[model samples]
Target chain A: MFLLTPVLVALVSILMVWIFKNSDGGTERRKGEARAQAEACPWVDEDLKDCTDVHQVEEDANGWQESEEDVEHIPFSHTRYPEREMVRRSQEYYELLSKRRSVRFISNEQVPMEVIDNVIKAAGTAPSGAHTEPWTFVVVKDPDTKHQIREIIEEEEEINYLKRMGPRWVTDLRKFRTNWIKEYLDTAPVLILVFKQVHGFAANGKKKIHYYNEISVSIACGILLAALQNAGLVTVTTTPLNCGSRLRVLLGRPANEKLLMLLPVGYPSEDATVPDLTRKPLDQIMLFYFLKTS
Target chain B: MFLLTPVLVALVSILMVWIFKNSDGGTERRKGEARAQAEACPWVDEDLKDCTDVHQVEEDANGWQESEEDVEHIPFSHTRYPEREMVRRSQEYYELLSKRRSVRFISNEQVPMEVIDNVIKAAGTAPSGAHTEPWTFVVVKDPDTKHQIREIIEEEEEINYLKRMGPRWVTDLRKFRTNWIKEYLDTAPVLILVFKQVHGFAANGKKKIHYYNEISVSIACGILLAALQNAGLVTVTTTPLNCGSRLRVLLGRPANEKLLMLLPVGYPSEDATVPDLTRKPLDQIMLFYFLKTS
Candidate 1:
């Protein structure tokens, strides 16, 4: 009976250890399941998951930059307009931009490459975080490559619409008339794929952090849109859901680059239509703080 | 001593449970410590921590949107430019924008409020994800309020530079000649504080998810910058670290609105200077995919 007691104790210890290990294993298994679900779902928010955060954690002691060399400061020239000219100029610019719309129905007519180059140059003039300029513009004109991109995006979007997205999202989007099918991918004469460099290498080959890279890149995109409008081109801004990795690999972008936006640039087709939408007025969007009653 | 065996068995079981509970508690304690450290650090990356993420997780079953009514589609009328005109317009636009520099030294000369209204109106034309237009432009003209903003920003920035940031970040910013002291915030005639609406209230008072709200607001800021430049104004884009919540509260912005970027808008001082920086060339930043030999 004494021997039996010892054996019982041993068995109980083994059972307790097994239960604890199994419970822990179950938690890990559920995490894996959730990740799998996230991957398959449509709204995969991989927009700003830059490698800088990982490197920052791993190399926390190294700080963010390696360059200690300072640049010289030069006097900034000014172009001050008369108050009346400023008002007139600002008003004219607003009228020009207000006419801009996101046109999805694009004609397959070829556009001047020089115009594209100039607009991109204007976009490059955007102010970046720490002046990193962590952006890449890939202009794809090959018909076959564009077709392949369309296929990949459409396939992923189909899964998103049919299997992942709930009825509410789908219903909300019915107004804009967007769906899994992307005819613009195949129809637009040119596709500008915008990639944000999550991190850049310093001259010494150490990682340089691109601070606020996503916001900087999007700002550049805003300028690109304005330039395109100025040049009389039409495009629809798109952030293809769950297609960044595949498109990155397809475009042969480096590991440091991730897709931020895709603009299919061309002229609008004859039958092109847009949802009749109106923007918030000046009072609704702009707040003048503590104004004097002068 | 007759019940000694049973007592010992019970003691062993109790000890095992205690060990398990203690180990789990250790993990939680470690996590809490890491979070506390993150809160104290200057590079607190609260840029895109929107409430939509939380709502999406909690209300995963309901989907993202609640509106089902559709808007009418209208024919898109576009102005097609001649190839020569397109090239000329694109080139002129690029040249005008390329002259823009992030000028920090601002004169206290008051800008026309009418121009400010026009610039903000132009920014409102930016394309947003799902057409949410989730942005608010707060123009602070009151000198006292601007001074208050300067105080809040400098207080946080002083902490960022002196206590939290490593020497590396300070070194990186040395070339730009930027420090915690922001005289421009008070000197500039206008302070435009850009805020991103993380979420909006639905017509039914339910939470409405503003998809890609950060990117949308950044894009709008981009257009705002361009409009300012077109109006011959000088401003610098500043994303003051760890000062968002305080500035938001100071501006009386709602909880749903998070500060994205702050631009102090006015004419550059006569002796205002800029760092001698150069942007990447077009060939370096742009890629032409598989050009045809025709």
Candidate 2:
């Protein structure tokens, strides 16, 4: 479903582009009339009759694109492309998504797979650096894979929980009541694995450089969050395993990429609970006048 | 408008609570029923039943509140709140807002004050840590204030543009064709300042630590963007200011707060032009698994 929507949008957008492109057939004629009038009279004439012959002259006598359609393009030579309506629409979609909250302890009911596909597709449209588009999403759905992933995660979590591989910083997570064990990861219907491809494939089997990998990955994740929420699914964004190397080996990830987070996605249980969190006031989070640059 | 909505929700919620509380006054009847049953039960035959003196039992029964209303009190006993249909309906209003964009140039119009108030109120509801909700938004609609801001930014921009702020980094920013010169400061009708409060004022008159300041501020800004856009306004997110101390001194900000970005909000000019920048493709930004944590 996710794949289909982008294709549909792409198809529709392409059609719209063709329609808009063909509509601008009158821009050239106006320019031609202006040029003919200028050539007919080098000086401002006392009589308006100085421009009489120019009205019938060929627009675009200079002949940039000398074709039958050129005659119809003279009036709109100054037309710029319309503003990107799709991008503006995307921003609005994300704004409504801002209301989505993470839910834990989900109910037994299964979330439709189509919903997940649509959400991932929305994430796929996020812009990246150099158009390299070097990201892959591995959706974990089967219970066995989730269990295996949990096992791999738990081994590292045990070490972290035991405080062998961590410092005082580990204790800080307790404020949010996070634990070494992540049960929701196993329980949630899906775990989205976000991987950044460090380089592109080359003919010689070598790697090509990728630019802005971190920023590109982050923006994509941001879009994914928005998409999932937009689709009415809740997600819990779990971050890098503080214990590090354990997760990579357990997840069987290639050396070229690292684990950023295992985002658990599903509906919240009727009894699901969240920390009673409050946000900072609006005044503190937005800047209005001080740092403006045109 | 925002203040009123939450206040009204709370007020109505409290009124419901009062109704529920007042009805609890006669709930003592169930106890009488249980006691009467205990007296009538035949345990050790007559001796057990002997306690059923009619007048005493009647007096005791009258003393206890009736339990017949228990069926009617079913909803009160098990708490369930109203459906958030209105909040969900609010999304449609935001969906219309999805048409707004981040324009580079803005028209100089005298922005109405009421519009600004609604946007700010919309911005205030963003979620935060421990409900700490740590953000502030300062909206500057004054023309003279904008000029002062532009002057200060120009001082920093001139230095950065000249390769004085590290040649390699400055050169990269130039690739985007961005410069320190800020014309939007003067061109926009409104300016919004986003700040994250690292600490909060405690009930004990002391500074309290705030958690997740970055995420908190980012969320609020996201809402602000939506609100402004919903109101048919465009905004540009600018963060060229080094802004730590320089802005603190300039804006009379407290030391605990830091600047994030300056947003110029208004309608786009009829003949505005923007850099022909293209967004990178989506695949490059979203990783299927964690780059480090998966």
Candidate 3:
């Protein structure tokens, strides 16, 4: 086990104090933001003094909770690992991810439905803009349905490879040699079709626009991939352009939902292969700037 | 340790055979995708036929490896946790995310530079659309730059709040009561200005269009936030609309890059507060369909 230097221990203590302090004062009054808002913008003609009153707080009437102001918040405590443990955990996660590949050839091996459910549940925990989890996972397991999707997707891909893509674009794909032929679509035991909700129908039947739907859905997809990889599954991230409307119609989905990705989830085939690509090294991808000391 | 049931062991053995088969046949030829591509379409004349010959594969002159086909692939082994261990890890991660709040009040407390580096490195490990990795993490610590950013963001936010937003938007924000003032921008010790490269510059200065830039960058940002939270740091996802052009200019970034997200990283203030919020339960976000056992 690695030991922390005295200076490093001091820095960690400071961080620990900050973390403890954050979870400590949950019951205390949180008037700082309201007070700052009122003081910072006095240009509003309405008297801003009443804004800081805790009694004026409005609670959600139709929300899941009785009232937003009265919502229960319990204390959160996290396990703090020693320096050696932290290093070990970080290295383990990094190594796990390093081995993950964008698999192209997949087998029709049957995966237990519970494994998929757990990963999707893990995906739901991703944070979204304004807490609007504007994403949905449609787990497709019916073989007939998967075959239909593959047929439709291949038709579009034929056009993409023949007329849609430019010469330069095709040249760039020389490494992977991917020419729109999606055999894995039908071969994989399950296809997770992800949809991004552009708008939701409120209780009043009015359309509510979702903020950052693209960004939020992408984040959820990332977590989903991580969960699947941790569970020892392999998949390829496939995007078939110009098939959104067709997919929505075919799947009998609502008009407000747009298909973002079609992921074929299963084990890699015995002779499966991926383009032996490499990510840019860490130094090229990261820039670290420390506070300058005089 | 929880023992695996005999039934589960059988299932796991099936899965293990599939996994081992994939990494075992290193010398096998991968003609499935290339053959499928050829048979699916007849448009690829003699020119495209040569593209499939393994001997004709182009070696990466500048890359760290030789030809993509000749590149060695090592065995990808994952840690198989006991059922109890799996449940515990999954629950722990979910609980950790549940407690994460979008903090508003930030302290100027100094954070170790190493912590920030590790998280950003974690972010860069996110999988991209086609291994493009078209994202840049610009760590901003200069006070002058932060001040300039604050001034420009506040100006745009003022217009967005008062002039651009509709009445419904303002009503939705009633709980937080957020106005044009963005004190956290300058108050936070570091601002991670994430820029997504819409296109890359080739060695010869030619433009290379990036696929799924928006989706890829968002995934990276999600991993970054998870890493930060795991490290016991707090941050808020802040987006100052219409300030992207000005920000690009101010930061002296290249034209191919666009501002994706502006994250303020620091310790939460002593009196820090967050809006009372709730996430929809798992059933609302996920639909699980098991394969018909018939």
**For all candidates listed, what's the TM-score of chain B alone?**
0.87, 0.60, 0.73
Ranking by lDDT: 1, 3, 2
By TM-score, the best candidate is 1
Task: Name model 2 segments beyond 4 Å from true.
Answer: A1-99, A108-114, A117-138, A152-178, A194-226, A240-261, A275-294, B1-102, B110-131, B164-175, B205-207, B219-231, B277-294
List, for all models, the DockQ compared with the true complex: 0.58, 0.05, 0.10
Cα lDDT tens digits, model 1, B123-174, are 9999987787899999999998999999999998998889666676677788
lDDT of 1 by residue, A1-294 (tens): 233366666766886786677557645755765565453333545544543555354446554445577799999988889999999999999999999999989999999999999999999999998888999999999999999899999998897778666665677678899998899999999999999998788876677767678889999999999999999999999988778889888888888898989999999999999999999888989997883456
**TM, every model:** 0.90, 0.55, 0.70
Better of 1 and 2 by DockQ: 1
Q: In order, what lDDT does every prediction score?
A: 0.84, 0.51, 0.65
Report the lDDT of model 2 for residue B277.
43
What RMSD value applies to candidate 2? 35.0
With a 3 Å backbone cut-off (N, CA, C), the pairs that clash in candidate 1 are none
TM-score of 2: 0.55
Better of 2 and 3 by DockQ: 3
